[model samples]
Target: MAFLAWSVCAHPHATGLLPETRLKFRPPPNSLFAVLLRSPWWVSLLIAAVLGLVAAALLPEAFRVVGALSGFPFIVIAAIAAQRQWRLPSAARVQQTQEAVSAMAWPAFQALLTDGLRRSGIEVQPAPAGDAVDFVMERQGLRTLVSARRWKSARLGVEPLRALQAARQADNTTADVPRAVCICLGGFSDTAADYARAHGITLWQASELALAMRGVTLPAPKPAR
Candidate 1:
């Protein structure tokens, strides 16, 4: 009789039963645990009932109500697990997006450097070597080699300045042509700036570059007569 009663009460087609009683045999959402449990409503109910039975069993006869209370907790845990599984993939995708942005750091800096120089009305030349140099700028009919480096810990040491001087001197320009500049994204060393000043070379830091490019637009050159 108990077996027949259980089968009828748990049956999906059982008549006159409460909606929740009918749901007790339905399937859970597609989660790992649900898959393991075959997503069957009976499995979840069975688990909950078993937990309640255990809790009730562990209590004194007078407090046996505790075991019967486990069903709600079991359902809550399953619901939480399902939600977590659904959100895990979204979290992973966000992490991947962050990594991609990090990988593009160098490319972003290069573009910023090139664009800033070009937009400042400077005629920039292609670099002979790596993508380090921002661009080659010209002003007042003088050919000036230009480079931009954006870094927090960067310092303008003597070596780069020496190389720039050497390259300019070796170029075909007349002796009176001024040397080029290395624009640092940050400030420069006091000694480095002083040395550049003494040698008639320009040292443009971030602030100076900002000021120089501010409100300045270059017009197209007219054709020579």
Candidate 2:
């Protein structure tokens, strides 16, 4: 049933997190057919009805079995579709939260992100002055240092992350810090991406922040170097 409805509705593209990258999800040319195909559960139910109608019109003598059995195959499918449709409102609310997050200023977005993380059971506090990180989070005796940066498109390099790693290493000597992460509102540069991947540094980028801020599971962190 999750796949029985449209996934992404194409709209004007946003200011991509990547300054130089474009993301696309192209649908087929026949939109009505596409929408119908998207809802296979409903389509299945419609087929059952049509079969029953055909039997009623042309085979009155044998219509009972057709009327009785034509619809059962789609009963489970209908239930699943109904469940998915019932969840659509919640999905819409999450999407609305995501949209608001996308358009927010750095300060407001950070506040929302902190609050969202808080709602997800993590306690967050502002990092120290000149600490090269933004938030210090704790949950179940684990601490994570997070860096959040805002850029128009994430064409930035890795020096900042390098500094954050250095800070984390420094704190390891005196604190219970086991992990640290970087959150770039803009996309990361190739060097930054590679460095994070190689070093096990977790990264949460622009496109992910919206859903993440709404309490969706965050992306996996990169492996440590």
Candidate 3:
């Protein structure tokens, strides 16, 4: 599991707006860990079992014990993957949740996002007037500027994200600059995603919103105006 504890380094100025941020554990694109994380938990477990059995059959008697331990890493990966996958809402639940979120008014949706972030132990504060950012979040001594006003947009382009990146840059003073996060119900365009990735902006779409609102009661949609 030590390999799972990779360090994060901020590479600001990669895109000349902000540093390239590796905010999450993004294993090498073609590595086994990446494959295991993407595949179902059961797949990892099956692979681990097969490895253990194969090692036992081929290894000498004395080395069999050591060989069997070769599958331990995969078992660990399976547990981690299972824990993450378990937290995600089911397909049906995600559809229902997204539908509910889409129907919510801006105020209600903002409140929902606030509640979700608070539940995750992040302190939320309102953004300053006349900014693209909707809220400011602080957790573990790091600040993140969150722009979620476009949550209902049909297709989020790079403009809103670029604004958020600018906001983050404006807020930066010292070495520990704030991170940027964008929330949209409608998915982002390919160029938007690429820009976010390049600038270290976290984009939360339908599936992510569903995951965040898990177990919380959504507010009823407002009556037609």
Top-TM-score structure, candidate number = 3
Which residue pairs does candidate 1 place in steric collision? 26-41, 52-67, 55-67, 56-67
Regions of candidate 3 where Cα sits further than 4 Å from its true position: 1-26, 172-175, 219-225
C-alpha lDDT score of every prediction, in listed order: 0.49, 0.58, 0.75
lDDT of 2: 0.58
**Model 1 Cα shift for residue 145 (angstroms):** 0.7
Per-residue alpha-carbon lDDT of candidate 3 for residues 1-225, written as tens digits (9 for 90 to 100): 465565445432211222233325667868888788778999989988998899899989999888888788778778767766776678977777788888878898888877876776667887865568888877656677888888889999999998888888778533676887788878899999999999889888777777666767876546688
Model 1 spans with C-alpha error above 4 angstroms: 1-106, 129-134, 150-152, 173-178, 212-225
Model 2 misplaced regions, further than 4 Å: 1-99, 151-153, 173-177, 215-225
For residues 1-225, what per-residue lDDT tens digits would candidate 2 score against the true structure? 323343333221121111111114444647543344348457767866777777677676756675656555455445445444442335555556545655657787677777766765677877856657887776655667777754334455788779878777777534554467777655688999898777667776544455345554433333568
- Relative to the true structure, candidate 2 has a C-alpha RMSD (angstroms) of 13.1
* lDDT of candidate model 3 versus the reference: 0.75
lDDT of 1: 0.49
TM-score of each: 0.40, 0.50, 0.82
10 residues in a row with least lDDT, candidate 1: 12-21
lDDT of 1 by residue, 1-225 (tens): 211222212221111110112234334558534463334345555677787888777888766675576466456445544433432224434333333322335556455445544555555566545443445655435566554543333566665666666665666654654456676544578777776777666776544433333343322333568
